[model samples]
Target: MATPVLPRSVQRLIDEFARLPGIGPKSASRLTFYLLRATDNQALDLSVALQELKERTRLCSVCFNITEDDPCPICEDEARDAHLVCVVEEPLDVLAIERSRAYGGRYHVLHGAISPVEGIGPEDLRVTELVQRVAQGQFTEIILATNPTLEGESTALYLQRRLAEYGVRMTRLARGLPVGGDLEYTDEITLGRALEGRQEV
Candidate 1:
């Protein structure tokens, strides 16, 4: 049977939703139909929220994290350790670290990792800004909090080389098994890292 033709507006919304990362055509169609069936102002609210997200949010000048303010709250907070900076792959990573509540220092969002396969490189990121920050001689250490993926590793290595001359202490986030994970189920990389980073009990 031929697929029934959808209205242009409905199809357009579905197509837009489908363009979002991790959203398949079927999921987009479901979302569009769900919005159509809704009696409340959810669709309008979503539209307004999206508009505000684009219009109101901007990158923090210092850290490159998404924020309504220029420096972002973390960068502006004087109580935080100004000399310690944790460099991460994206704005979401900053949020993840914040949720941990273990890090009391500020952050620097790289926007993305160095993925040559995806055509992303240091030039495409805020590397220049980070280098400039390092050259300013304010930070005493830089924690490389990039993920353990190949791209993340490459980005971290490149950053290390670039900032080595600045003489600021550079450290990587320790990789290991999870708190409750089984040793048998753990991957070799994580297990090895755990062994390498083992601390005296």
Candidate 2:
């Protein structure tokens, strides 16, 4: 069999693209070719934007959400209800809830849910930080907005037990969402109704 004749730079770009989720070798090649045909300024702008994303972004210390500053805008905003905290599996999930505009509480990003098969346990997540936050007794309500998947349910149950000592009211999102669907994909209207109709877990 003859060896492929791709240039080193082209091969490298293909490999990098393949590493991204949902991008296969064929799509990667298409993207690389598209970028090659794009104006130099377009590629340069994309490169600069990617560089600045990592360089300028930081995790908010309070909510653990991605932000340019230590405390995220939601955490810093006085108008938000500090007495309630919404717990989600990822930073994107926080954005999802925010888009609904029904939740006025602060948020805690767990980063990941409890995936036993994937070796992701409670210790692997931001559970300790949540415990500390609950101990502070600042929040009276904690809404477990983790997805409606098995791992998400397990995480919420675990948190419910762990946080019981804090005396803060605990609730979970209404289960009208399709099981195993990512919260990030749910529309704002559905998510808003889910939040509003949340029940004690």
Candidate 3:
């Protein structure tokens, strides 16, 4: 015998919540019910926040990081070393690095790594823009601060080859970061040490 169907509205909310990463059916049901019982103002606030997040947030034209501003505060900050750029896989990685307070260089967010399994390539990333930026400006160094995963290593190597003609010093993060861990989840102390001990690629 088939299970009885839930009310369509409740089922729809559960389905939406279940689609989120790491949210199982049970958790989705809990969240949907919680939201249903929440104050109308609270739920409306969340809905309005989500709408504004989509409307107010945009990719920074220069670094490709998600920001409310075009250049982003980091890119616009004259105090940062423009000649030394740290290239990361995503905006979350940028936050991880910033939390360490170990770097004072500008950054270039690739938005994602080159993953063959996912059918993502260098062309899918902000690689061409980085190359053009290097061509336009005489940068001294570039750090391939992508994660230590196989896909990250592949992306780093691809960038290395592509930027060979630039003659700019390229470096990779040290082993302080766990081999298979993501930068966004790394502790600040370990991330700081990795930045401090970064080595030539």
Q: Provide the overall lDDT of each model, using Cα atoms, as 2-decimal numbers.
A: 0.94, 0.91, 0.92
Q: Which pairs of residues collide in model 1?
A: none
- List where candidate 1 sits over 4 angstroms from the true fold: 1-4
TM-score of 2: 0.86
* Candidate ranking (lDDT, best to worst): 1, 3, 2
TM-score of each: 0.96, 0.86, 0.84
Comparing 1 with 3 on TM-score, the higher-scoring candidate is 1
lDDT of 2 by residue, 99-196 (tens): 88899989999999999899999999999999999999899889999997789889999999999988899988775566798899998867887787
Listed per candidate, the RMSD to the true structure in angstroms reads 1.6, 5.9, 5.8
Which segments of model 2 are wrong by more than 4 Å? 1-3, 177-201
Q: How close is candidate 3 to the true structure, as a TM-score?
A: 0.84
On lDDT, who's better, 1 or 3? Answer: 1
- Candidate 1 lDDT trough over 10 residues, lowest sum: 38-47
Which run of 10 residues does model 2 get worst, by summed lDDT?
172-181
